[model samples]
Target: MNTETSEIQGSCHCGTVRFQVRLSEGLMTARRCDCSYCRMRGAVVVTASLRDFDLISGEEALSLYQFNTHIAKHYFCSRCGIYTHHQRRSDPHQLGINASCLNGVSPFDFEEIPVNDGVNHPSDRVSRGGSEVVGVLRFVPSNR
Candidate 1:
């Protein structure tokens, strides 16, 4: 919880979904998950307690998607199909903010991001926070 206390604004691709999040430590918890769905979507995520996230607007324009165990509640913009944030399956107390959706921030600013083994989550398995290390990812900013 040792972080610069700041409120950051963010929106979806179509600008329909808007939100404000209070960062506990800016991007200190930024990371990527190696789960089946996460590996394909390829979004950098940051942690925020449930009290930290606020939907500024576009609740009606939002849609939800859940798969497999269905513990993690993933949200997106119905119009823009942009991933916003999700209730972490591993830690239900935190919402995993999509780092790509944060304003004035780039995922590439970090040289390295740790990957979580979401494929074998603690909820689904007996081991809590297993020692299985997936891999680290390097964010390369796109020209466009």
Candidate 2:
């Protein structure tokens, strides 16, 4: 991603939902989670403060889903069913923007993304520690 551009535009698959965000740490913060939901959804995410995220359109087309502790709120487009972003359960003040939803970006764009151990969430730890990145997800494109 371009470090020079802090703010970027995003939308769902069907374009029913659109938004703008200022990434907290550019694309360097991109990561994946090993939690059940994340494993299935399979989206690489980057961080952004809640105040830095702006929902430009499709308020009615947005649908939210939450489970388990329900601290994190996952959002997707109701029209196209594309996961857009989510409120971080570890830090409610921050939102995790699906990197693929960002314009001109794709999950495969990152070669190696740290995979967090959501199964052993830091908040649930005895000392309430920080994120535990278990491993890395790598994407190597073959010659076509």
Candidate 3:
């Protein structure tokens, strides 16, 4: 899909953690994941290259969480307990930024978002040295 480069600023609730990220194509790639962890967190995310993400402040206020394969790194604010973003295992080159955190952006703005099948993450079935197919995300409309 074609995308336009956009720079967006964001922060955790209470502004304890601040950041700015340059998205390759704005929010055209916004989505949700269906893994158990994601289902509970219920965040809508968009991709950003690691180098494009800048933590402007509040490093001491940030906390981390990892699980399962431990490939992804989740970062949140200890002060407000808001999820800011995560280093994605599926795409090591990109991080998933919380869509709700972007300044003036709302999750309700998305008409529909794709849902990734993180529960059946391809790495589990594929050979260690080989790659597996991560099936396409389905178009799931929001009921709101």
Q: Largest lDDT belongs to which candidate?
A: 2
Q: What is the lDDT of residue 33 in candidate 2?
A: 96
Per-model lDDT: 0.83, 0.92, 0.83
lDDT by residue for model 2 (91-137), tens: 99999999999999988888899999999988899686898889999
Question: On lDDT, who's better, 2 or 3?
Answer: 2
Model 3, 71: alpha-carbon shift in Å?
1.2
Local error of candidate 2 at residue 50 (angstroms): 0.2
Residue pairs in clash, model 3: none
lDDT (0-100) at residue 128 of candidate 3? 50
Query: Could you tell me which residue pairs clash in candidate 2?
Result: none
Scored against the true structure, residue 85 in model 2 reaches a CA lDDT of 97
lDDT value for model 1:
0.83
Worst 10 residues of 3 by lDDT: 129-138
What lDDT score goes with residue 106 in model 1?
Answer: 65
**lDDT for each residue of candidate 3 in 39-113, tens digit (9 for 90 to 100):** 899898989999999999999999999998889999999999999999988877889999889888778777677
How close is every model to the real structure, measured as TM-score? 0.87, 0.96, 0.84
Q: Which stretches of candidate 2 lie over 4 Å from their true place?
A: none
Please give the clash total of every predicted structure, in order: 0, 0, 0
Alpha-carbon deviation at 37 in model 2, angstroms: 0.5
